[model samples]
Each structure stands twice: as structure tokens, then as C-alpha cells.
Target: MRVALGDFLELNLRVRSADDARLQTIFGFWPAFLVAFALRLVGLFKFPFLDEEDRMMRVAVNGLFGYGPQSGQAPFWENLLFRTPLSNSQAITPLWWWTEYVARLVVKDETLSARLPALLTGLIGLALFYWLARQLFPFPIPALLAWLLAVHDVFLWVGTKAQYVESFIFALSVLIAWALLVAQGKWRPFVVAVLASTTAMGFFLLKGMTLTFNALAVGVAQTALLRGGGRRLNFETIVQRAIFAGLIVTPLAVWLLAAQAYITAHYQVRVAELGYFRGIADILYALTFGYGTGRTASLV
Candidate 1:
């Protein structure tokens, strides 16, 4: 979200000559992104919905369009606090459903309404990926990498799909990592510290388990900073870092505790649901054979 146009241009200026930057912008970034956008547009209109997408759209319709009690018109307080729609499993998130719902409300075209979020977020993620690459790599390498990812068939496919708004979470993860690692100011770290905490909660709202992994990765990175470069940590510095860690973790902790209560209440309701393993045997099979089958399909 902090990827300002000025900052992007400034970073490019720092790394390359103005003419080179202009050439890369003209011949590298814009062309690649435009091609990528066009390809995803093709998929959005031409490709048939897959089974997973059909299921996701079904859930979205049930929540957003269904009448009677199935309608998504919850009280604002309940909508804010309850985890009724946000699942622990890998189904579409409530946020995604609401996004499509709002799109439908605005546009009245089911296909466009359903698929627009993926296309938009996918474009955002692609842009962020390019920016992050520029930060790490020099000159044309970043542009080349962006071009490759733009034409990647899998990425294009996912970009156009309705159920694959993982792009949103991916963009958020990229932004969070970029902010925490590349920030250069006194108050900026503190601001990022607080925003990172809220972002974890936002991740939880978007997808289960991603919040935990993202928080752990950021925590480990910060911990590395504490012990990095042979700098001895004084007691006061240690205390300040501890407080900083606390500030970054408290929001996520509160959300997780609240979510646990809701999950416990709903435990009985999830029995034998699709994608819910029944026993240790099912889990073991999934860990070994099930995922391999997907890889095999990909290779095919």
C-alpha cells in the first residue's frame, strides 16, 4: 500500500541512469504488465470455471444472494466480531465473498462481478512483485523477472479465476515484508510495527493459518535483527525490543483467542465436511499421496 509512484521512481533513479530507467519503464514494465493484463482478461472471459471455483461461487451465492436466514445481512456487530463465515479450511474467505457481492451490486454481471477481484488483485500483486524485485536486484534483471512472471501460464490462469484471490494476501505479505525490511526512519519502524500487528489480524480474517506463518516469519526476522552484526544488546535495548515485539503481537493474539472460542463452538458442525479429514489415516494419506497427485497433474 505504501508503494508510492514517487518512491518507485526514486528507487529506480538511485539504481540506474534516467535514460535507462525510462527505457525499462517503456520497454520492460509497461509492455509486460499490459500483456499480462490482456492475457488475464482473455482467461476471465473465455475460460470455464473449474470445480473449486464452482464450489466457491456456490458458497458466495448462498451467503450473498440467498433469501431468508441464509442471507449475508448480519448485524454490523456480529459481522465485525463473529467468525461464522471465515473458515479454518481452505475455502474462500468472507472478505472475498463480500467483495464479489459488492461488485455484483454495482455491476449486475455475474461473471464480471465474480472474477474482477482476482484480476485486480493479481495485477496489484504483479506490480508489487516487480517493485520488490527492483529493490533487491539491479536494473534489467528486475525487468526481466517481471516479464517472465507476466507470461507465466499458471500465474495468468490464477489471475483470471474467481476463487483465487490469494493475490490479495500475497500482495499484503509482500508489502509487509518490504515495509519491515526496507524502512529507513525513526518513527517509520514504530508505525510499521503497529500496522504489522493489525495486518496479521487482517490475514486471519482473510485466511486461516497464513496469519500464524506470516507473524512467525516477521518475528524471526526481527529477532535476527536483534542479534545481527555482532552488536551487543544492552539491557535497555533488550527491554525496548521486547516491548516492540509485544506491540507487534498483541492484536493477533487477541484475535486468535476470540477465534478459538468460535471454532470450538463450531467443531461439531464440521464433521465429515469435504476437505475435512476424518482421522489420522486421512491426514497421513493427504500428507503423502494427495499432494503428490496435484504435483503430478501440474507436471502433466
Candidate 2:
């Protein structure tokens, strides 16, 4: 009897499989994607123009054509000196300039050109949120959390508008945290930490006061990790750890220094203006339950 060729091929291809695990992962993502898509669609019609949205639009417009609110010379000495350093200084990341330019090339209309980047950035933010959540938690929980975030009205609202750096900062912070957690004292994690920190620092430059909160959060997380059961620190150990931390954080430190230099040379503006209030009620409202213009509903 001759062995069939197909039989041998099938035997060779057969291996230990996690088909069930794969299926669960695929199914898990469906509900979250659907909910996020629906929320974003609804937001397009419900709130087309928000205050920060206008600011983002202005920034994009100024960035693209080198025109708009920052166009004319101002009377305030600080505005005259600090803001005028760059002809169209709008306190935006240089990355936005490239994004704005691409938008202008694609769409001739100023309003559409301005709003396009925010829409794109919002989508990126949502995707990053899901990616980060998945890295932190097991299957359904992360997916479920992502779904909750997806339909969140305020996030959806902010996603549609421009000038809000929280979404971007939040996403970068998540990536940095994930990289730090998974890093085995490797170069890749160090590189990622540096890049993520630099990007987050852009938000700080755009609005200076994020520095304190960001610094505190990073410090607490690092201290917790260092102290948490795995490692012991002596004088030599402490010095080594300090050196490692410094290497990881140097990029952010440099960016902060540059931003501070810029601010100091030109303005007497209070850094406190960079901080904003989001009351406990607002946090509870946004995270635990969703709030609309006039009503609130449970996220679950």
C-alpha cells in the first residue's frame, strides 16, 4: 500500500494549537470596535464645534498657512516677545505643522483643513487607548474598558475637537508605562521611554503646568516599581539606579529645559494658567458614568 502525499502533508502541518484562545481574542475586539465607531459617528452630529475645537482649528490654520490669530503683532510685552519668536507661534508641537500642511494640500477649504488633523488624531488616540488597555489587562476586561472609553461622550467630544492635549498625553503616557513594565533593562524599552517622554513633553511645552503632574506620576510609578519586592537598594545600588533612571529620562529633561528657556526669555506669564480643574464630580461623571449636555448615564 502506498501512502498518500496529502496524508503526509496533513501530518506534518499538525501541531499544538490554541485555536480556542485565538477565537476568544478575535471575538473580544468586536463589541469594543462597534461601540467606539457608533459613539464617534454620533458625536459628529451632536457637537460639531466646541471651544477647544476652535482653538485647534486656529492652530492648524496658523500652522499651515502661517496665518490667523497670531498673525498681527500684539500690545502685551510677553505676547510680543514670547509668542512672536516664531512668526506663527501658537504653542503647538512642530509635528502639527506637518499634519496641517498635509491637510491643506488635501483640502483647500480652511475650516475643513483645520479640523481634519483633529479627526485623524482622535482616531489614533482611540486606537492607542485600546492597544494600551489590552497590554495592561487580560482579554475581555481590556476590551470592555476600551468599549467604555469608546462611547464616552466627553472623550468623544474631545476627540472631535482640537487643542486638547490630554488625549494625546494620556495615550503616550500609557505606552511609556507599558514599555517600562515590560522592559528587562533592555535598550528597546529605554528608547521607547525616551521617545514617549519626549512626546509627552510636547504637551508640557504647549501647556507648561503638565510638568508637575507628569513628574509626580512618573516618580511615584518608578519608586513603586523599584521598591516592590524585587530589588534591594544600597548606596552603590542607589547610584546605579539613579544613573539608569537618568538615562531613561534625559530626553524629557532636555525638552523641558528647552521649553523653560523659551518661556523665561519672553514671558512673565504664570505657569499656573497651564493647569485646569477637573473636579471629582467631573472625573466620576466621565469615568464611572457617562454624562451628556443635560443628563448622565452609567457606562456599564
Candidate 3:
């Protein structure tokens, strides 16, 4: 997404030179990201898969390797977004299965292949975490905070796992928030607006309910804090914002409509991720207690 990259670059460009120059120091932003990514990769394939991982792996294997209508599993591209080979309860979490399936193509080890998505996404998230933190915080604080989060049991244990969507969600949430902050400025860079809306769209597609809460909270905060801090909102501004929002939401909404119809016709039992809420809770718990953020064997 050129728009997304532009927003990220503009984030740095918007910052003053003194602040930007601080990012080039010894304990700079990229170094923090690299260190954090390395730490998160510690148990990439060491610990056993969580129950969630097992569930996704099943769907992933069936989708990638299964053949025939009698096999009872839908192919990922055509008929499968939510349904799993084992049960309908498995269908609710669609993104991970697709990702795991792709990873399974080159990786023969079913379990490890399935886990690649989380590991890779988690690494990317670590990098983005630093950039977003830098956008919001000053200098080494972003670097320091990134290091702390790297070691945080909150992220180490559950957030980095393949089956969980929270790491991706969390990173995307930050991107959305950053974009909003940038768009709220009087300058209103088109790329930033698109990025904010696009990120919002992606987050919603991943989990609509979860994204709803997060978007509302972040949207309100950004609006109140940044909006109108520079220039007054006019009709044109309102129209522009509405158009951008429409662009962000309309495509996803259409996709969901088609998806819902397909799901209803194909797999009638509307199971909304048996582990979806629990997985979310696990992430929250990790954030709170710093447990399950890393290997069960080590809290360090």
C-alpha cells in the first residue's frame, strides 16, 4: 500500500528535525525495533502450540491439503473464509487459516508452517510498534518502551503466537491511530487520510466488534486532542472526511455482505469463534498480568 507507506513516511517528516535527528542516535528507533523483533523470535517454534493454534492448524491443513467434496473441507480461495474441516465453530477465525495455509506451501512441517504467520506478523508489529511509539512519544522513550514491550510477557507469550490476531490487530490499531492524528492536522494529507481509513477497514475485517471499540476510543481521542487544534472544520472538511471514511468502509462492508451470504448458504451454524472472545481475554490478561506473553517455561 503506497498510501500506507506514505503515511508512515509523512509521520517522520511531520516531526521536527531535532526530534527526527534523535531517531538517528545510538539507541535509535530502528535499533529498538530490531532488538524487540529478535526478542520476540526467541520461542518462535519452541513452545507447543496453544489450543487456538491447534484449531487453526487443523483448518489450515484441511484447506491446503484436503481434496474432494467428501473430504468435507472447503478450499481457502473459493469456498472457505470461516468454515473449518473439523467443525463450524472453527470458521469464525478466517484470516489466520488463510495465512497458515500460505505458509504451509513451502514449509512441510504442518505445525511450524501454520505458525509462520504469527511469528512474521509479530516481527513486523514489533517494528511498527517502534515507529508508532516514536510518532507519539519523544526520542529514546520509544526505543526504551519498545525494549520493555519486547521482554513483556504480555507480548512475548500470547501476542506473538501464530493463531492469535491481536498482534496484527494491535499494530494495525496503532497505524490507524497514527494516521488519524496525522489527518486531524490542518494540512490533511490525502495519503494519511487514506491510510487511516484503510487501516480502519482492515482492522474491522479482522474483527468487527473488536475494531468497533478500538476505533471509537481512538477516534474520539484523536478528534478531541488533535482536531481543530489547528484549523476550524468546514463543510468541505466534513465532506472530505466522510468521503474518506466511505472509501475505507464500503469495500469491506461489501465483502462481508458476500461473505455472510456464502457462509449462511454453505455453513448455516453461525459460530462466532468459540475461542475468539477467550483469545481476546488472554491477550488482555497478558497485558495486565504479564503472563503467557512468552514461553510458559520462562517469564524473562
Candidate 4:
């Protein structure tokens, strides 16, 4: 039995472990690692300005000791507790809020407190991308391509910003994509994708327009996956999956809708102030690695 098993292993190895395969895998993964390392090093030196960082900090501080500038009628801490039920609240998720609060206990300085969590999250994002890419493109080239795309300048710029939503969105996007691609019809991967989606939704709630594009991208991906392989679109299967997905999404969606309604009701202003900063033409540039370009234009 041992000899037979050894023979089988040898045959399988001979078939799969070709020199070309090994080279491709190695080449694919190396660039991603180099890019991630470079970005992390750069992040340590220069802190980029993130508009949402202050709001996240406020939420964290409010969650910790319960005082916030936007608190009305109720104490900020009490608001955090109540806001948990609503989709988009002034409150951070309890776990993340506590983590920030704990970090604050050590760091003390507000700026450092905000930046450290984001930096660490960015590192986690990098590692996750590597793992996911390796899994998705087992040979390495595809994995490297995906990783390079994931860590493009726009993503890196966003990742470096303290408390920015883009880092989380990018991380969760990679994770969910990998999970969907590799899940063997298992509940665990689905659950993980759901959680990652929830986190991505949080980014959407936080940044609104910037993350909305990501949400739409994920939806398109999901549709493509469902439609792939000419799989029969059975109503029962579709409904079942929808129900399950909805279950997973309920908390986050409820929170988002609630927050939007609350903000609309109170402020009488749209929660998301939308404008084309770089213009529609710039999107072509952005799609073709034009984000970091210096060209500036206004809407006609």
C-alpha cells in the first residue's frame, strides 16, 4: 500500500510539478510582495490626508468614552449603542470600536491612534491579497497580475490614508472575490464572503460615492459568476441563494438605510454630496492608469 501510494504521488508530481509551472508561480508572486513591501515602507514615512479619517476617529472616540460633537439629546456613547441597530450611524462596529479604543489606551495621541489601525489594516490587506492571489491563480502569473492590480497606485494611496474606507474596501473585495472563486460549495467560504461584503458595505456607508462603485462592481461580479457555465437559472436555487445572501446582508443594509433616512430627515441634505472631481473623461484615464496623472479639468 505504501509503495502504491508513493508511486501515485510520484506520478501526480511528475504531471503537475513541471519547471514552467514552478517558474510561473514564482514570477507571479514576487512582484506583488515587492510592491506591498514598498508601499508599506512608503506609508510609514508619509501620511496622506483622508477626508473620512476624522469622522472615523470621531466615531471611535465617541464609542470609547461616549462624547461626540454630533451627539444630540443623548450622550455620544449612548448614541453609539443605539446606532448599532441602524445601518449608518455615528457608531463604529463594536469590535472595531473596541480595538481602536484599546489602541488609544496605548498610543494616546489622536493622530497616531487613527493612523495605526489603518496601517495595520493595510498590512492585513496586503497579506490577504497575496494569499488570495496565490490560491486563485495557483500557477503564480495570474495571482501576481491580480495582486499588482490590487496594489495599484490608487489603492496604495487610499491604503496609506488613516481611517480611509478604500483600504477596507480593497481588502474585502480581494477576499470576497477569492472566496467566491475557490469555495467548494461550502458554507464557511460563503459566510466569509458575506462578512467581507458587510465590511465593504461599511466602507460604502462611510465614503458613499467612492465605495458605491466598488459595491456595483461586486454585484456585477456576482451576476457574472451566477450566469457563468450556462448554469440553469432555477427559480428555487436563485431564491434560496438570495434569501441566504439577504440574511447575511440584512444587518448592514438595515444600518445603511436607517442612517440615510435619519440623515435625510434631520439634515434635509443628501448624505452623499456627489460631484465629478476628475470629470467623466478622467475615468478613461483612471481606467488606463491615469489617476496619478497631473491633468486637471472641470465639468463643461
Candidate 5:
């Protein structure tokens, strides 16, 4: 009877402890989020021309308005895949470009629209970072880390600018957090692997090559380190890890193929219009043609 009573009491205490921790996490997140939002909000509207926001806004504008003489000739898929903004090499990530274009469509303000994605990802990253920290550390540490990240100048700068850094970091945070959870066995490995791989791929579409390699490295390193600590990784776990590594690489390969096809089609259109042979002959023709016509002879 005494043993039964002690066991019941211990269980009750643990339940209450978990409830308190849950409440603390809930409370910590809102305050940190609000404060971070307030800090980042001003930068969104105030310094709109910082970094590559100008260049990205131009790309987004071209994405909405179409690019080059072949702009109208492009199929829906061509427009969807190629956002190089009048050239083949200047392509921003398709997802980010679309985000900017859609926001511009609704908001009708170029700078604000371009910066919105970064601001949103910044907030989302804060939430993910806080959750990950809470899972890995004690109460005050998670809360403190959340506040610190929220106030960090670099995070603040990138989070409010119109560029890929904030989104890339946000994607990286998601990958690392998911990896850690899988390592801790808090979730089913297969489900987590699929979801994390998909998330990595999706973000790779948004930010391109950087996220792919980072996701692969994080998966291998986190799983290996955790598995090294006396717990033998099963065959299924190995297969899941392999699946994740493969999935992450798969997106990059597919994207490169699509990008190459789009660029080739786009340049073909440019060449037919500009009357050049092939392989950057258009660029050479432009320089020489200008000089031959005496348009650029004054500079010489």
C-alpha cells in the first residue's frame, strides 16, 4: 500500500511539472514574438533600399510584368520556372520570386512586398528556434535564447530585408530542429524523415542550393552523433536516413534540369529576335554591333 501511494504521488508531481513547463513555454513565446515583431516592423518600411532589396524588387517586378521580347511567348510553366528578369543568369529562387510577386499584387507596394517574406520567415524562425531550444534545454535557457535571437542585430537586419538570408536560416532552423527531434526519438523516424526532406526540398525551391547541402549535412551529423551514444541505429533508421539524404539531393538535381531547360528556351527566343548564332554570340554581337554602328565608338 505504501509503495502504491508513493508511485501515485510521484506520477501526480510529474504531471503537474509537465503542465507548468507547457504553460511556461506558451507564455514565453507570445511575448518574445510580439517584441520581435515590433522591432522588425520598423525596418521593413524604413530602410527599404538596403542590401539586395533593390535588385530583388526589380526581379519581382519583371516576374509580374514579364521579361524580354519573348515574355509573351513563354508558356505558363516557363514563366513559373524562369524568373531571370530579362537575362538567363539572374534568376532568383522561384518561390521567393513568386512570394514577392504575389505580395506585390495584393499590396501594390514593391519594397514592402519584397520585404514581407523575410519578415514572415523571421517570425516563424523565432517560433521554431524557441520550440527547439525548449525541447533541448531547460526553461530559462530557452526563453533567454529566444529573447537573444529576437534582439540580435544580424537577425534583425536580414529578417527585415528583401533577400534569401532570412528564409535560408529559417529553413535551416526547421531542418536542425526536426533532426534533433528524430534523434531524441520523440517522433517516428520515417514520418519525420519524409516531412523533413519535403521541408528541405520546399525551402530549396525558395533559397536554392545552400539549403540542400546544409540539410544533408545536418541529417548525417545529428543522427550519427546521437546514434554513437550507445543506441544502435536499426536498419529501418538507416534506410530512413538514406531516404532523407537522397530526397534532399533530388530536388537540386530536378531544379538544375528545369532551370537549364528554361534558360535554353529563353535564350533561344532572345537569339531569334536578336539574330545571333549561339553560345553568347548575342552578347558579342551587341558589343560589336554597337561599335560597328558608331554607337559605342565615342568611348574608344
Candidate 6:
């Protein structure tokens, strides 16, 4: 088959296109993507207020309410709760808080403000997932992955109208995934450092360290590849990692200190008798065995 190179290239592209079309057909691809995004917006104004969504709203508008009267209550009970020396705490990630904070300024309802960012971010995640899949995998397969995720029941429910912290968490996750995929290629270590650092900072601001911890794990993997067993990491690479780590933690540390101080000044004294580690364990149990965002005594 003495075919011309041009013809071979054209044939390869056509085969790829056909494969993508077939996968989309089997998966209900575009209809599902469009429908999923639309469905997320359906009854946007009518979706009622959920429980913890209000507490997060408080974190934004009311400042840190750690060690308040919510003790023996639900926010600490239902979801994975982080404790930092407080009897009753409400120190959620600043990202969603501030987001809902600003959203409150515009949309004057509890449910809409809290869920607005979630809805927007979830849709962004959907589009970005497709791009990320293309970056991480070859055609048709990437297309398939995006379409499957579009209609995924649990993920779609959480990311879209659930209005949980998982919304923006999911959004930032896609950004982090994109950054990770690009970092695998020609991006300089410093570029990856910036991408990762900023993403982790924003992620920390929105949620607690759970996803931040995942980001750290990914950074470690990338560092291993960057080292490539060729030689020990140089001083500059060390510095890059150092700066990256600093960018990730410093904001959180400052936020915690200031938030803690402010809460102590404004609210009743926070008691640490309940134990911070205990709170972490309780939350772990709730997430693992209990509902994704509600309190349960599954292990406690």
C-alpha cells in the first residue's frame, strides 16, 4: 500500500473522528452534557434551603463562629468537621464562605447565594473535565470519559444543585487536574509551582485540607518524576518546592490564627475538652459510613 503520507494522516484523523462519534452515540453524549448542565439549572430559584448550607453562609457573613452555641449540633455532627481547640466550631473554608458572602451581596436568599457558585463551578468543571480528559488521554476515550461523568448520578447531584462545599471543591479539582496534566509536559517546574500553589491556596480557602492533602500527594508524585533518578534535586528545585509549600500553607495559617483570635474575642470562650483529633475521627466516620454531608453516629 504505497499511500501518500498526506492521505495516511487524513485517514487517521477521520478514523479518530468516527471513533469519537460512535462513542458519543453509545453514551448519549451531547444530549447528556447539555441536559445535565440544563438540569442543574432547572428550578434554580425553587430549590429549597438545605441544612449545613446555612452554616457555611454564616461563616461568610458572620465571620468564624468557632466555639459557639452550635455545640451538640449538626454542622459538627453530620459533615466531616475539623476542630482547632474549640468546643463549638464553624471554621469552614474561606473560598465558599467568601463566595457566598459576595453572592449574598447580589442574591439576597440563603439557598441561591450558597448554591450559585456551586452551579456555576459544576458546569465549569464539566467543560473542563472534557478538556482535561483530552489532555490526559487520547481521543474517543477522553470523549467517552467526559460524557460518562456528565450523567454520573452521584457526582452530578453533588456538583450541581446539592450546594455542598463539594461544588467548588469539584471545580478546583478539575483545575488542579488540568494543571497536573500540563505539568507532565513542557511546563517548567516554576510554572507548575505557581499553578499548584495558587490552586491549593484557593482550595484551602474554600474547603479544609482534605483536597489540599490530595494536591500535596500529587505534587510528591510529580517531584519524583521531575527528579527522574538522574541526580539529586538541586537547590533551585528545592526552593521551588519550598515556595510552593509556603504558598499553600501560609494563607491557611494566617487565616486560622486571625479567625481563631477573632472568634475568641467575639464569642464565648471555646473549650478544647472535646479534642480536635476526636472531631477529625468523627468526621472521618461520618464521611466513610454516614451520609456524604450529614451527621451520623455510625462509628461514634
Prediction 3 TM-score vs. true: 0.66
Q: Candidates 4 and 6: which is better by lDDT?
A: 4
TM-score, predicted candidate 4 vs. hidden true structure: 0.58
RMSD of 4: 8.3
- lDDT by residue (1-300, candidate 6, tens digit) is 557888999999989877776665456445657876776776455555565444434432433333344433335322122222133222233444456556777887756665677778777777777766665665567667776777777666666453355555566667666666565433364454455445544444324345555666886787788679665666775676667657656765676565555444544333222223333334334333653334332222
What are the Cα lDDT values of the candidates?
Answer: 0.61, 0.52, 0.55, 0.55, 0.60, 0.54
Worst-scoring 10-residue span by lDDT in model 5: 270-279
How far off is residue 65 in model 1, in Å? Answer: 2.7
State the local distance difference test value for candidate 6: 0.54
- 69-179 in candidate 5: lDDT tens per residue? 435655646565654432322223355555666777787676777788789888888887887777778756887888888889888888887754445446455655566
TM-score of each: 0.68, 0.59, 0.66, 0.58, 0.68, 0.64
Evaluated at residue 19, the lDDT of candidate 1 is: 74
lDDT of 1 by residue, 1-300 (tens): 467988998888766676776787788999999999999888888999777676555443444555434356554444434433343223312455556667778867777877887888888888988888777776798789889989998778777887665666666666666666666223565456446445533533434344445655775676578679665546675567668767766765665556456555655223112244433233224433444334321001
How many clashes show up per model? 0, 0, 7, 5, 0, 7
List model 4 lDDT by residue over 131-204, tens digit each.
Answer: 66556555655565657654777666655555444566667777776765776345677667767767665544
TM-score of 1: 0.68
- Which portions of model 4 show Cα errors greater than 4 Å? 1-42, 45-74, 78-107, 138-153, 184-186, 206-237, 264-300
Q: For model 3, what is the alpha-carbon lDDT of residue 205?
A: 38
What count of clashes does model 3 give? Answer: 7
